[model samples]
Target: MGRRTPKKKSREIYNAWNQTCWIKGVTVNPMVTLEYNEWWSRRVNDNISRPNLEEARSIEEYLRVVPSELEIIKQDFKKKTSELEKKIEQLEEENVYLKLDVDL
Candidate 1:
């Protein structure tokens, strides 16, 4: 009988470790996911093995910009809501005046 090679033993150990990891509900780290996605995108874009620092920097900038943009949108919504409420109140007062005129 032939003996298993060290590479085969290592493969078996790796498989066992993966199985145990799944059974224990161990998850892939979010940083690992982000790194892997960035690496994969870089590979697809330039056929390169390393992440693109420029692209990563741009993504960081976009993340920073998003909150300020969201704040502007929220403020606009609040202003519109207040304007609508004032219009509603004015219409209600007019309605009450019309009802009194009709009753008289």
Candidate 2:
């Protein structure tokens, strides 16, 4: 493997933070975001001082800012759908958008 340049490393850290830490549709608290980013910076940066330290530090800013987005989504889904909702009259409907929130 080849060594990554400083700018490349910075961009990679920034991209990783954005992709992994962002929870959509929620207002993140500033203090919490700061703490989260600090933790992530320590983990990824490992005390290595560099020109693009800001991007690496930014990765930890996400800390489930909405409490529990998944739980809320699940509860809402269950409230809206019932046992009778499982039935579909059109057999072909099964072939389209088939997804199992089910696991075996």
Candidate 3:
């Protein structure tokens, strides 16, 4: 009987802890729901106003993204690489001609 009593008491404590955990886990705030509902209704019902012509910007200006310093450096490097490649090709052609002239 004594052993049974301890087991029953432990079971009751476990049930109570589980109940508290279940209650804490559920978020049932009616105030937050009401505020969100009100905001949603206002957003859905409100009229969208047109932009003022005086302050309106062109789509191209609004969408244009400025290149960063890294991007500018990459472009310069690419140009220099292409120029060096062309010079290498020219030197190789001259070497081939010089080799042919020596053979003849």
Per-residue CA lDDT of model 2 for 35-72, tens digit only, reads 78889889888878677755554535654356488889
RMSD of 2: 27.7
lDDT of each: 0.85, 0.68, 0.88
Segments of candidate 2 deviating more than 4 angstroms: 24-104
Candidate 3 local lDDT, 1-104, one digit each (tens):
35668889999999999998877667545335777989988887776676799998999989999999999999999999999999999999999999999999
Residue 36's lDDT within candidate 3 is 91
TM-score (C-alpha, index-matched) for candidate 3:
0.44
Clashes of each: 0, 2, 0
Ranking by lDDT: 3, 1, 2
List residue ranges in candidate 1 displaced over 4 A.
Answer: 1-67
Q: Indicate the worst ten consecutive residues by lDDT in candidate 2.
A: 95-104
Which candidate has the highest lDDT of all? 3
Error of model 1, residue 4, in angstroms: 44
TM-score of decoy 1: 0.36
